[model samples]
Target: MPQRLIASVLLGHYLSAFTTLGIPLYLPRILADLAPDAPGWSIGVLFILPTLCTALAAPLWGHLADRHGCRLSLLRAHAGLCAGFLLAGFSPNLTVFVLALMIQGTFGGAMAASNAYLATQLKDGNLSRALNWTQYSARLAMISGPILLGLLTASGMGLELYRVLAWLPLLAFVLILPLPADAPRRQARTSDGDGDEWPDQLPNDLPRLLAVQFLFSFAMVVTFPYFVPYGEALGVGNDALIGLLYSLPHLVYLVALPWAQRQAANLLLPGLGLLALTNALQFWSDQPDLLFTLRLLSGAGMLLGFVGLHRCLSQRSRNGSAGRLFGWYDSSGKWAGAAAGVTAGLVSQSCGIASPFLVAGLVAFAALVLARPLLIAPREITA
Candidate 1:
């Protein structure tokens, strides 16, 4: 595990997340300019599209990385992202902008491929720590991108907004070019009796792990898309400030990850319990003071849940079925995210934005209830 390799993966993580954050920050602005009369329904649909695309595309991209070289797959995805940003920034109309975003999703799982590269290069003992750090880099990117864009958008640079946002992906593309490629792993997995395809006999534990990821991710999705609006209704109107609120829990989690791994040995159950509590707080909180307080609590809980989930996945991968297990984990998570996005969006449209959070909290509580059984069994390994 050379430092440069981790740096490279972390850098990629940052860029991918930065680009993803930029889309949402500018989304309201985009709608205002392009579809001023559009209702929540339209905005909600727009919100769901990218996640839907990513959900559909991630597995394919992961499979490609498994069969092809991770390095090539990564380079190709970055190139696609560069092109997608340019298209997004330069689109002549709304249709073109969204189509470009759809294309972006087509290349969306570069992060997964990048992670695979990290796992392959990292020594066993260091892998979870490295992945946790990688998660932090991404959290940092998400935090920075939205704040930067909000500042730029508020400055009224007008159409220059697109150009400014374009710089994130452009810089990322430049940074990624020099990173090392994953050496071809055992001559690459191929089809038809080559024993090269992704592993066939995934351990039963893999599905259980994926199920947990899906449930947790669903809880996240239920509230994430609607939280900004909910906060606004409670009189917290600053976009950058709201972004800060949204991100702080991740910051807490980022700070806790190294220590949790070192001390807890098994962070999964407690993490899920905290997460469920956070969502429960959000579900009932609406008063301005109460909302902010719940948000702070939720953030802390999220830190535990997400970081613990990543640690578990990293540990699971060490048993020799890294590709299939991690891919299933990501796929499950993305599908959960997509389902949450759409469900929450539709619920918000019909029942008001707060409804989604209320429902989301209940779902998180249920996930917490069931998580203990899923993780209680002894760890298992794949051949």
Candidate 2:
């Protein structure tokens, strides 16, 4: 693979990360300004609408990529992201803003498109390494994007934040224009004598792998929304420290990339085991120091699951089907993330802020119990 290709993907992913995470970061303010009369339930629904749209629409877009070409598909995602932000920035009312975000979710699957494009260009270890690099870009953005936005706000550039954000994806779109194109590898016909259509390389046990994806994703992301609050309740006072602790898993991934590339999907099982133990243990940890240790351990578990799943999919990807395979793979995660956030919110309200972690731990344990043969068996290839 060309270094320029990977660099191009990483830079685009990092730039888009702002829009991905930043919009939600400031959504409360945006909602208050646009819809002061909006109900509380509606606010939560609006916050999650984009994710739900993405979950439902990813496969359609992926199939389009499989039929046409990945390069065009990637450009379509960037263009969609650019258009969505532009609409959000210039919207005259709340309805337009809502429509704008829905469009964004339905179209702007840049991460899935990027991974699919990379998969078309790579195989085996190279594929896994490229996937890890894209992850690194997002992790790096998670730590820095907030600080960068904060600095801009401090400088009084916070007015019409969406307007400022629109430019980032536009820039990313232009950056991707020069990368190599991946033409589709279509089969001439199926056994039924169909015309030229891309056939899927699906094995019988695909649902099993997807189940593991959903459970693992749910276990990990279910903790995200309430992590800071959980830390505060545990007597960790510094906001900066809390931020760092919340980011430990991402930070750990950065430091462990070299090792992670070597291990790949092999980490999934042990990772779930460690995550379950640490999350359950956190419930009993009253001291800040112990919470700190548990958070770090949880990060390691997350790293294992992330690498393991990506590599497994990489190995499963067959010619012409990377887009569809990775897209559906991501939809499982998208659905899990949305569900996890809602579950965490409800659990924290009814139980305690710490209860979500316990819930997440149990989900991981259950997944581990059910995931053995589906996850650990040798790759089920398509001819």
Candidate 3:
């Protein structure tokens, strides 16, 4: 890929990730502003509603991208996201805020669109590397966004920060406008003496892959919404520290990517096992240092397992249905995340905040079992 295209994709990923992950950093404050008397579980509800919408919208966007064009899909998604944030910033009550989130989810197919677009541009080994780089951009945003929000919150500017941040995506939309247009690739598959291959359907392994995605999303979401409050309960109350804890895994994930990509096949089982172990260990630690270390280890596991899984999926792309394929993949995860949010809230309400981590660990173990049959020695991709 040309450097200019790479830059554009990175910028898009950064803004998207920032806008999405950044909100959760100040979610408590946002809720307090919108509904001063709202119960704690409302946080989970707020996150759940938008994700459910995204899940429903994803496949439609994918199908549209394949039928129409990815450039148009990209423009529509970014514009919708910009409007959603603006509406959210101006919301006067929890009801209006929830509606705004629904709008955001309805329009937010940029990640899937972006992935499909890139798949058309790069092939084989180059494709996997580009995907990893895109993920790296998102992980980088996951780190910087919270830290920036933490600083703003500590400086007494948190109240108006979300409104200010709403404009960032509009800038991203402008950045996207100059990129080359992408048309659908719908060429029929040709036989090469081996037999026939259908272009319209997903790979045979996709069902199992979707199941893995669901389990992965379920595990992550169960612990995510409660991380900040969990840290507060453990006596780390600084906004910056809380943000660091939230981002620690991704930070370590950035460091582990190259190794993970290289050792993907060898690392899958161990990585998932480590993830389960780390999540389970959370139950035994209240110390900030110990928790941070655990999160860092979790990042390594994520890089190994998810990077490998995504590479396998990308390699299976056929026909012109990359958009539709990835859309379904993304949708599965979001749906799982939505369910996990509600379940996590219920569990936390009846049990304790720390209990979700254990549940998440158990779920990760199940994912490990499902992943075993799918793990193949990845062929080295050369640029």
- Best lDDT goes to which candidate? 2
lDDT of 2 by residue, 294-317 (tens): 888888888887787677777677
Cα deviation in Å at residue 145, candidate 2? 1.7
Report the lDDT of model 1 for residue 382: 47
Question: Model 3: number of clashes?
Answer: 0
- Ranked by lDDT from best down, the candidates are 2, 3, 1
Span of ten consecutive residues with least summed lDDT in model 3: 187-196
By the TM-score metric, which is better: model 1 or model 2? 2
Pairs clashing in candidate 3? none
lDDT of 1 by residue, 48-130 (tens): 67666767776666566655556666676677776776787777777887887787777755566566667656644577777
**Runs off by more than 4 Å, candidate 1:** 34-40, 157-164, 183-201, 232-244, 285-293, 318-324, 346-353, 373-383
**Model 3 segments more than 4 A misplaced:** 34-41, 92-96, 153-163, 185-197, 228-243, 264-266, 284-290, 377-383
Candidate 2 local distance difference test against the native:
0.80
TM-score of each: 0.83, 0.92, 0.85
Model 1, CA-based lDDT: 0.67
Give the winner by TM-score: 2 or 3. Answer: 2
The 0-to-1 C-alpha lDDT of every candidate, in the order given, reads 0.67, 0.80, 0.76
